[model samples]
Target: MESDYSSAKEQYAALGVDTDRAIQLLKKIPVSMHCWQGDDVGGFEHAGASLDGGGIQVTGNYPGKARSMEELRSDIEKTLSLTPGSYRLNVHANYADFSSTGFADRDALEPEHFKSWVQWSKENKVPLDFNSTLFSHPKASGLTLSSKDKGIRDFWIEHVKRCRKIGEYMGKEQGSACIHNIWIADGMKDIPVDRQGYREILASSLDDILSVKISKDYLKDSVESKVFGIGTESYVVGSHEFYMGYAVKNQMLLTIDMGHFHPTENVADKLSSVLMFVPEILLHLSRGVRWDSDHVTLFNDDMKAMAEEMVRTGKLDKIHIGTDYFDGSINRIGAWVIGQRATQKSLLRALLEPSEKLMSYENDGNYFARLALLEAEKTLPFGAVWNRYCEECSVPSDLQVIDEIMNYEKSVTALRG
Candidate 1:
């Protein structure tokens, strides 16, 4: 079958990538949504501070100076105006609500709100991707299971059931309309010597929760195709390793967040392990510190190396661009877009460059160039209209949209040759 270049051009133009070739390149790229509430707990303190209780101290950042819905809508318009094809705007359930002790204090996610949000998102022509929907204990400080944490375990079990219920309901009605996002905030610190039981409990809960999918068949034959994602966290691993088992058990082929793994922990090996197990891996793109801290996408040399390795190893196929930006700022939106663009360009260059004797070891393969071409030909842009509204006032309009993207393309292409 002949590839229609005109259709491709139209599609790319819609997403803000102007060049016909760039659009064509972006056509095959998979884009997914990432969701987060600006803050999990609105100004408060952890009373008594149970291991699984909320322990946040009010840092005076509340009532987070956010933009009105109108501003957000305008940003959405701008985003869609650039990339007009099918893309996802990932969202979470707790953005406007609060939770305590592993329970969403808001009772249930209001049906009206969900419908309205989904409807509004579609009206803006942006598909919604729900993340952390099943993550029930946003208000909790840490999640664990022990004789001391039987309470936490009880909460964990109940939370899992609650999430399963939500998945079932949403699956029945609007499940197919959006992606079913999953990430675990369940882990504990200052553990007792008996770690075996802790691992068993967490792993069992995860298995049981995953089983909900099969029983409910949320992804079975829904009207809207649901995409499920699992995330990794640096804090998850320790000397004995509480998170390694959890990571190993994520057998489903889904999205992988780039910033979740830390370099101090051998990110390359962790990522490689995930890739090896999950045949179909979708990457969540973001930049983080190698030592500690997921401080947004300020590029680093180690990350460049990791990205280069992932691409060359054919892991780019399961990748999607994502920004784990927590701060409510217009700059966050811009940073997400710019960061992905810059990272893609830089990685493309690394992938495309011919074999050189720069490293101690080398592989005689054309895979790197091939991966670069694949990424260049098929990367998709996500529209973060809501984030823009939250941070629009503080951000400086440094460059024209076209100019920024063009520079991105040139930089990536220059690195390519």
Candidate 2:
């Protein structure tokens, strides 16, 4: 394997590509892993809470899903062992650790509710990120934050406020900034009489929520948008335009979820434009089949294009990359490993591109040569470099990862059933 990597490295060097530097750079970029995939988005808010309410849905009935915070952490540890490179755990407010004591409603939540998670992150040496749980609650039936009923709106606003405090606590404890993302499933199923009224209310509600000042060093805030959801097929209150303008005016990070836009819209194209105004942006990397289905990510063209654009623009540090998908049909740990590895592979391939040479060709007006070079870079030995990276990181590479997952299932996950 070393000999093969050496030969591939020399070949890449001929094209002005440094394979070793690419591997090193890839190792430093951490992909935030979502915790919802381990349990099918069923948080511990209540024992039998319906998982079908939110604009989101998790398909299949895979066995061995984590039923407690301990089990979820165990599954995450196993998944992290298989995945190479650094990572952070993205937790939803619903996943609060309230096992020792009784349940606390969303409005009553505090930093104590999530102390165990902070400790677990510290022990694992992985940072924590947060999301306010705006779905699967009673108040979310009609609209939250934008509801005409002021009481319902106040409930969600208080919940989000507490979530921001918790995010600050996690960041302070971990000595790194925790990104607190806000997303809501607040929209009407049918065409409404007053679209402007709902947006105006939502804007006012957001202003109130953001008014609670938390240190920017501890908690970074970002707002996410959606094109359409299951119950929100007609109109979405927080459309892309609304949040884009809000994020720009407020100087907050704008989160772009790949599944939240139209099927034909290229999210990669929006990155350069959005970053031109906002200081930074967050990405929820998910694969949408026809709509926002949240399928497990693959090393497809969309993934490649996004990674290529990030590399080409020379703005890798300005983007926060995170995975956001839940596939309940397969081994949950395996799902995490597969999606993260695919993302890392796409990034590595993008790093291996002869971008500078291609740019030089274009600058000289050699369009045909530039096109040919771009096409030829695809056939390079990317897999060889990827294998070497896994080895350097001391993780199972190639087909060996499958065997490790199977072993884990037989030894640990299978016994859960």
TM agreement with the true structure for every prediction? 0.58, 0.98
Give the Å shift of residue 362 in candidate 1.
7.1
* Residue pairs of candidate 2 with colliding backbone atoms: none
Candidate 1 yields a Cα-based lDDT of 0.41
Candidate 2: Cα lDDT at 38: 91
TM-score attained by model 2: 0.98
Tell me the tens digit of each residue's lDDT in model 2 across 1-417: 989899889989999999999999999998899999999998988875566556877888888888878888999999899888889999999998887767899999999999999989989999999999999876777899889999999999999999999999999999988999999988988998889999999999999999999998899999999999898999999999999999999999999998899999898899999999998999999998886558899899999998998888898998989999999899988888999998899899999999889999999999999999998888888888999999999999859889999898888888888
1-417, model 1: which lDDT tens digit per residue? 013434544444553434433324443443553433223222111222111332212122323222333333343444333432235565555442222233234234443434544566557645555543323344344553222366655555554355445444444554443335445443334434545665566556556556654432353211111111122222231222333334445545444455554334445444566566544444555554443233445446555565666655665655444444343333323434454444444443344323232221234455665556445533432122211221222322224545643554344322323
Query: Weakest 10 consecutive residues, lDDT, candidate 1?
Result: 220-229
Angstrom error of the Cα, residue 315, model 1: value is: 5.3
- In order, the Cα lDDT scores of the candidates are 0.41, 0.91
User: Could you tell me the lDDT of residue 352 within candidate 1?
Assistant: 35
